[model samples]
Structure formats: C-alpha cells, structure tokens
Target: MKIAFVGKGGSGKTTLSSLFIRHLAATGAPVVAVDADINQHLGVALGLDEAAASMPAMGEHLALIKDYLRGTNPRIASAGKMIKTTPPGDGSRLLRLCEDNPVYDACARLVELDGGAVRLMVTGPFTDADLGVACYHSKTGAVELFLNHLVDGRDEYVVVDMTAGSDSFASGMFTRFDITFLVAEPTRKGISVYRQYKEYTRDFGVTLKVVGNKVQGRDDLDFLREQVGDDLLVTIGHSDWVRAMEKGRPPRFDLLEEPNRRALCTLHTAVAAAYEVRDWERYTRQMTHFHLKNAHSWGNERTGVDLAAQVDPGFVLGEGLAASA
Candidate 1:
C-alpha cells in the first residue's frame, strides 16, 4: 500500500513519517520511505549521517527514469514525450517494491533501521541554482512519475513525506497515494491546511484521515476533534524521544512513549486494512483524468503529441508487466 504524510510546515509530518517507516520496517515488512518534501531531512531522522543519507536525487535523472519506465510502450512515442502524469500502457515497465530495476538502482539506497532494512528514496532538495530559475514541482515530478509506474503488492509499503501544506495539491501527485495522513497540530495554522486539503480533495474520492501531532493534554486532543471530528484517525502526543532524535541524539524505537507507539500501531492497522480495498478501476480513472488535464493544459503544446493517447485502453495497473510480457 502507498501512504502519504502531509501537514503544515511545523506540524511534525516529517518526523511522524520517519516513525511510521521505522515502525513498519521493525515489523520485518518490505517498506520504502521517500523524502518528497523540499526540506529533505528524512535521511537524518532515519539515523543516517548527512553524507550517507544523501543518495542520488531522482530529480536530477528525470530523463533516465523516463526512458526506463517508458520501456517499449508504443503509445508513449518517446521518452521525451512522457510527461510526469503519463500513465503506463501495455508495453510500459512496471516496478515492484525494492525490485532490482534500473531506476531503483540509480536512485534508491538501502539503510538499516531499528526493525529491519528499509529502502530510502529522496526527491532531492531545492538547490541554490533552483532559486530563481525553477519551480519545486519540476523536482517533485520525479516522485509522481515513480508512483505512476510502481505496482506494490500485499505486505509491501511506500511511505511518502509530502511537501508541506496544501502545496501538495499543486500537481497530480496528491492523488497518487492510497491514503494521505494529514498530520495537523493543535493550532489554527495547522488545522487550516487540513481544511484546505479536505476542500481540495473532497470531490476526488481520496481517503483522507487526520493524525493529530504534538498533543499535550486533553485540551489539545479536544481541539483536534472539535475541528476535524471523526476524520482524526489517531493522535501522537509530544515526545521527548522525537525531540532528542531531532537534536541529533537518536534513541531506540522502543523508548518511544506508549501512547505515541500505540498511535503508530493504529496508523499501521489502518493502512494494512486499506491494502484489501485497492481500487484499480478508480485508480486508473484518476490517472487518466490527470493525464488528460496535463495534456490539455501544457503537455500537448510541449510535446506536439496528444498525450491522452498514451493511456492503454485495456492496461491494468497491477498486471501491467504480466500483460506486457
């Protein structure tokens, strides 16, 4: 299953995303953690030194990735015409979690965490050169394309720490995940994004659940419930362990407080239950919707081809490789 953590800038979404990845990894499950946020500190949070955590950025290798995923798909025309929202067709390559593929070999790194080995992939950070010349979406498009081509199965997980705030809605990337955990603090600024995200994704049939972060007492929990109501899936209290980890003095996952640990378990249970309900039909429709949206908006003009034709009429997502083979 694919899961995403999103919230306001200071709402601890990155920290929570790291904890969830470690929790899933400790269970000896196949998991991949992606730092899709512009800030890009998920590596340090997972206990890697700055140097080791800095794997090759996916953004820098867009052409290579496009070429590999495009495979022999006839509808795509060429790698140059493959936009970020392009869906895989009959002959396109599909990826499995931790699979030995060219894209994974080039961009993913294996790191040992508390429970087990977890693969880490990063969207790369906004460099100084990108300051005035580029938009962050161009860099994050790598993640969207990766998710588009990936076909994860049962017991396999992909956890993404999305960009802060509703900026995630800037592209079709927001619609890529199975579930999006909206991490909101007990602040107006925090829940404000939740409202914005809810409104943005309301018509899209997204399974959005709120995870209350930094809860101190009954009042904080009450505040979250008052604002979000039943949309709150779980609440993680303030943790000295997380604070210490942020300070560069990391500790064992077992040292985390009980309530926070339970919260993580609840999240895992929710995500696991979601795996049973993978809606491939709806998923394909969404992929097509965004592909057409992009094609009409800019892709056609840029590529001089009707990108909508790239969608394979009979191509099913999870069985793409088998069908193509």
Candidate 2:
C-alpha cells in the first residue's frame, strides 16, 4: 500500500510518519520511507545518523535517470519531458521496484537508506543553488515519476512524508497516495488545513484521514473530535519520549508510550483495510480524469502533446485488474 502523511508544518506529520514506519518494520513488514519534504528531517526521526540521512537528493540526478529510463527510446529525451503517470508505449521504459534494471538500480541508490528492515530515501535539503528555481517542484516531480513507474508486491508498503501546506495541490502529489494521513493538532491553524485539504481532495478520490497529534488530555481530543468528527481516524497522545528524542536524547522505539504505540497500530490497520476496497475501475477512472486534466493544462499548453493519450494500457476504463497498475 502507498501512504502519504501531509499537514500544516508544525502538526507532527513527520513524527507520526517516522513512528509508523518503525512500527511497520518492527512487525516484520517490508517498507520503504520517502522523505518528500523540503525540510528533510524524516531521517532524524527514523533514527538514521546525520550523515547517512544527508544522502544526495534524487532531483539532483535527473539527467542520469532520464538516460537510464529512456534507454534507446527516442521519444523521451529528458526527465522534464517524461510524464510519469503516462503508460509506457512500444518503445518506452517500464520499471519494477527492486528489479535489476539499470533505471531501477540508479533510482534505488538515489533514495535507498541502508542498514534496516525499513529503508529510507530522502528528497534532500534545499540548497543555495536552488535560488529562484522551483526546487520543491523538482523534488515532488522526481518522487511522482519514481512512484508512477514502480511496481511493488502487494505486501510492500511505500510511505511518503510530503511537504507541508496546500502548495502540494499545485501538482498531482495528492493523488499519488492510496491513503493520505492529514496530521492535525487541536489548534485552529491545524484544523484550518484539514478543512482546506478535505475540500480539495473530495473530488480526487483521495482518502483523507485525520490523525490527531500532540493530544495532552481530554480537552485536546475533544477539540479534534469536535472539529474533525467522523473524519478523525486516531489520536496520538503527547509524548515526552518523542520530545526528548527530538532534543538529542537517546532514541528508543521500544520505550514508546502505549497510547502512541496503539495509535500507530490503529493507523496500520486502517491502511490494511483500505486495500480491501478494491474499486479499481473507479480508481482508474479518477486517475484517467486527473491525467486528462493535467494533459490539457500542462501538456497541450506547454508541449503541444496529448498527454492523455499516453495513459497506461493496463488501466482500462471499465475493467478491474487483479493487481495494481
């Protein structure tokens, strides 16, 4: 299953995501964590050392990626010209995650975090050279492309920590996830983001679940319940352990508070339940619509190409596939 955690900047999205990843790993599940945020702090939360977490961003190596994927196919000349969601054609490239293909190998190296059951890959930090450039777009685009091309096992989990705020709406990043956990605190600003995200994602078929974070007592939980109501999935109580870990204290996932651990387990169960829905036809239709909309807006206006025509053949309009496309 593919899951993304998104919310207001200080809403503890990263914290929850990291804990969730660790929880999955602890249970012997295979998972890959992608830090799609510009701040790039998921590594710290994942217990990776500073240097290991600071690996090169995939956006920095687009040229190599294009060459590897395009191969002998003359249709795509650059990564910027690649429509990740577009299905591969006669001469186009396709990728299976963890496969031995050159493109897969290169992309794996770019994002893979070593030495754990749960691997991590980061979009890297924003640098001085990114001044005046749409750097965040570049990172988001890279992740989108990678996800679009990846083929994973049914049991495998791909969890992404997305950038904060509504800026992600500018791209189709919101549509890329099977479930998007909107971590919201009990504050007004946090609930405001939830409203905006809920309204925006309603038409996209994106499952927006509210994960209440930093709950101190009954009042905080009450606030979230009042604001989020049925949209609320679970609540994570305030953790002094998490606070201390963030402040350079020794790390210990095994020592997590019971409430926090239970919350993570509840989230895992929710994600597993989502996979059973299996409304592939509806999902394909939504994806096709999104592709067509983007094609008209970006492809036709900018490149004179009918991007919708490139929709993957495997995703038939009225048919349900046994596996994910």
Best by the TM-score measure: 1
Tens digit of per-residue lDDT, candidate 2, span 1-325: 7899999998898988988888877776678788889898988887666776777677766666555555444444455566534433334454543445644344443322222466566777777878897557666666776665454555678899999988768677687777889999999999999999999988877888999988888999899999999989999886877888688573567788887888888898888877776455565565566566777767656656666655655543221112121
lDDT tens digits by residue: candidate 1, 117-183 = 8889999999999999987888888889989888887788999999998679878888888899999
Which segments of model 1 are wrong by more than 4 Å? Answer: 319-325
The true-versus-predicted C-alpha distance at residue 83 of model 2, in Å, is: 3.3
Candidate 2, residue 151: the lDDT equals: 47
Q: Which candidate leads in lDDT?
A: 1
* CA displacement after TM-score superposition, residue 105 of candidate 1 (Å): 0.8
Off by over 4 Å in 2: 67-80, 89-104, 107-116, 300-304, 312-325
lDDT against the true structure, per candidate, is: 0.88, 0.71
Candidate 2 lowest-lDDT run of ten: 316-325
